[model samples]
Target: MTGRFITLEGGDGAGKTTQAALLTDWLEASGRTVVRTREPGGTDLGQRIREMVLHERGHVAPRAEALLYAADRAHHVETVVRPALERGEVVLQDRYIDSSVAYQGVARGLGADRIRSVSEWAADGLAPDLTVLLDLDVTVGRARVAAARGDTFDRLESEAAAFHETVRGAFLDAAAAEPARFLVVDASAPAEDVQRAVRTAVGALVGIPAPDPSAS
Candidate 1:
C-alpha cells in the first residue's frame, strides 16, 4: 500500500496536538500503521533545530531563521518522514511548510514566495497529500496560549498580536490558493467537532469511512 501524508496547520493553541492524537487513534483503530511527527523536531537534528529556532532567547535574523527552518525540513524529510512513508505508513504531521510560510514568510515580512521556494527546495518538493488547516481567530488563539502557557511564551508565540493576525491571513490565502490540497475547518469549535471534520476529510482522501457523527 502506498503511504499518505497529512499535515495539520494552525496557530498556537489551535488544538493541533490534540487533534493529531485523536486522528492517530482513529487511524490505528482502523488497522493502519501511523507515523506521528512534527516539524523541527521529527528527527534528532530537528530537535536541536527546534530548540534553537523556537526557544532561543536571543534574536535571530529573519533570513537566518528561515534558513534554519529549511535546514530542519531538509533533514527531517530525508530522515523521518520519507522513510516512514516508504514503509507504507500514514505520516500524520503536526505542522509543515505552511507554518514556515505563515510565520517566517508573511509575518516576518520576508516575502511568502521566497520562503516557500526555500522550503520547497529544502523538502525536495515534498508536499502533503492533504493539509488540514484549522482556522481560528488570532485573539482567541492568543488567549488560549496565555491560559495554557501562563507568562512563558516561545519566540513565535511571544510575537505581537498583529504578527499572529498576519500569519493567520497568510494561512488563509495559501489555503485559498490551493483549495484542493487544503481542508479548512473552523477551529474555534469544540475539539470533537474539529476532530470529526478532520477525520471526514482524511477518511475520504485515504478511502476509509469516517466515523458516523451519530456514533459520537
Candidate 2:
C-alpha cells in the first residue's frame, strides 16, 4: 500500500513550514516512516529552479516563473516524493501545486485553469491526499514574514494586501471545491493552536491517532 501525501500551504508568514516540522515529528513518533520535503528544493534541479522562481539569480517572466515552478515540482515528485510514498512512508510537503495556483494564477493575473494544466503536466497527476492551508489576514501575514529571521521575501511579497485578497480567495475556492482534500486553518491564533489544528487534520487523513500532549 502506498503512503499518504500531506501538504502545508499559505501566503508568506502563514507558518506552514514551522507547522510542517511539528507534524513531521509527531507523525514520525508514531512509528510511520515519514519523508519531509518541499517544492523547488527536493531535487538538485528543483533547487536551481527554486532560486530561479524566487528571483534570486535572474529576472524571470511571470509566465516563465510559473512554468519553472511546475518543472521543479515534476522532478520532485518523480524523484523524491513518489518513491517514498510507494514504500508507505508518510510524505509531508511544505508547499504544493496550490501555491502556484494562488500566487501565480490568481495574484499574478494568470488564469487558474492554465496554471492547473501546466502544473498537471509537471506533477504527472500525483495530488496530495490532504492539504493544510494556513489562513491569515494579508497584512498580518506580511508582518509576520517581515519579522522572521530566516525568511526571505519573494517577488510576491511586495504586493499589497489587495493582491493577497485574490490569492486568499483562490485558496478558499480551491478548498471549497475539494472539501475532502483541503483544510483551511485559521493562522491568526497562537502558533501552538495552528500546530494543533494541523495535527488533527493529518491524524484524520491517515487514520493515525495523534499525540495527545498539549501544544507547547
Candidate 3:
C-alpha cells in the first residue's frame, strides 16, 4: 500500500516546524512509519542549496532563486520523498511547491504560474495527499519569529512586512483554490490548541480513532 504524503506550509514563525514534529510524533505513536523531512535541506545537495538561498549574503536574482529552489525540490523528491513513500512510510514534509509558488512567485514577483510549472516539472508532479496550512497575520507571524530568534533573520525572514503579507495572501489563495487538499487552521491560537486541531485533521487521514478525553 502506498503511504500518504502530508505537507505543512505557512509563513515564517507560523509554527510549521512545531506542528510537523507533533504530527510525526503522534503518527509514530499510532504505529505508522513516518519519514519526516523538509525541502531545500532534505538531501546533501539540498542542504548546500538551502544555505545559498536562505543565508548566503549576496543578491541572487529572482529567477535564479526560483531555479535553485526547484533544483533542490527535484533532488529532494527524487531521492528522499519518493523512496520513502514507495516503502510505504508516511512522508511528512515541512515545505513543498506551494512555498515556492508563494515566496518566489508572489512575493518576489516571479509569477506564480511560471514558478509552479518549474516546480511541478522538477518534482515530477508529486503533490501531497494533504496540506495543512497554518494561517496567521503577517505581523503576528513576524513578531513570533522575532521573539524566538533574537535579531537573526534569514533571507526570506528579513523581507519587509509587505513581502510577507503577499506571501500569506498567496498561501490562503492556494488553500481556497484546493479546499479538499488543504486544511486551513488559525495559527494564532495557543500551541496546545493548534496541536489538537492538527491531530484531529490528520486523524481522519490515517484512520486513527479520535482521542477519548474521558479515557485519558
Candidate 4:
C-alpha cells in the first residue's frame, strides 16, 4: 500500500508549520520516509504563485486568484506530491485544497461548489487520508502571526478581521463535514501539549505506536 497522505490546515499562526515539522521529525525517527512540503510553495512554480497570492500589493479579482491557486496546485500535485506517495512515503503538507475552499470560496465569496470543482480537478483524485486541523481563535491566531513577523504584514495581513473569521469558520465547517477524516487540535495550547495531542491522534489513526517522547 502507498504510504498515507496527511495534510495540516489552520488559520494564520495556528502552528501548522511548527506542528508539521514536529510530526515529520517524530515520524522520521520512527522509521518512515516522510516527504514534507507546503502548498503555494514546494515546487518552483508553486512558489511563484505563492508570491503573487500573498506578497503582491496589487489586488486580484477573487476568481482570478482562485484560478492561480488551482493552477499552482495542479503543478505541485503532478510534479512532487504524487510521486512521493507512489513511492510509499508519507506526504505531509502544510496546506492544500482546504485553504482554497476557505479562502477563495468562503472568505472571498467565490462559491464553495465552484472552488471545490476546480480544486478537485487540480488534485486529480488525491485526497488526504487524514487531515489535522489546528484550531485557534482568529484574534489569538492573528496576534501570534503578527508577533512572529516583527510587526510587519503581508497582503493577507492587511485583510479585515471579518475576513479572518470567515476563513476560520470555513475551516471549522470543513472539519465538521469530514469528521471521520479529521483531528482538530486546540492550537492555543502549549507547544509540548500540541505535540502530545498530534502524536496521540496520528498514532491512533495510523495504528502505529507513538514516537518516543524524549526523541520528540
> What are the lDDT figures for the candidates, one per model?
0.92, 0.84, 0.91, 0.88
lDDT of 1 by residue, 17-126 (tens): 98999999999999899999998899889899989998989999999999999999999999888898889899999999999999999999899999999999999999
Candidate 1 Cα misplacement greater than 4 A, ranges: none
Error of 2 at 82 (Å): 0.7
Q: TM-score for every candidate vs. truth? A: 0.98, 0.92, 0.96, 0.95
- Which 10 consecutive residues of model 4 have the lowest summed lDDT? 207-216
Candidate 3: where is the Cα deviation over 4 Å? 213-216
Task: Write down the TM-score for model 2.
Answer: 0.92
Model 2 clashes, total count = 0
Q: Tens digits of per-residue lDDT for model 4 on 24-134?
A: 888887788899999888899999988998888888889889999999999999999999988988889998999899999999998988899999899897899889999
Screening candidate 4 with a backbone cut-off below 3 angstroms (N, C-alpha, C), the clashing residue pairs are none
lDDT ranking of the models:
1, 3, 4, 2
lDDT by residue for model 2 (179-207), tens: 99998989999888888778877887777
- Which prediction has the highest lDDT against the true structure? 1
lDDT of 1: 0.92
Candidate achieving the largest TM-score = 1
How do the residues 29-122 of candidate 3 rate in per-residue lDDT, one tens digit apiece?
9999999999889989999999999999889999999999999999999899989889989999999999999999989999999999999999
Q: Superposing all C-alpha atoms, what RMSD in Å does each candidate have to the true structure? A: 1.0, 1.9, 1.4, 1.7
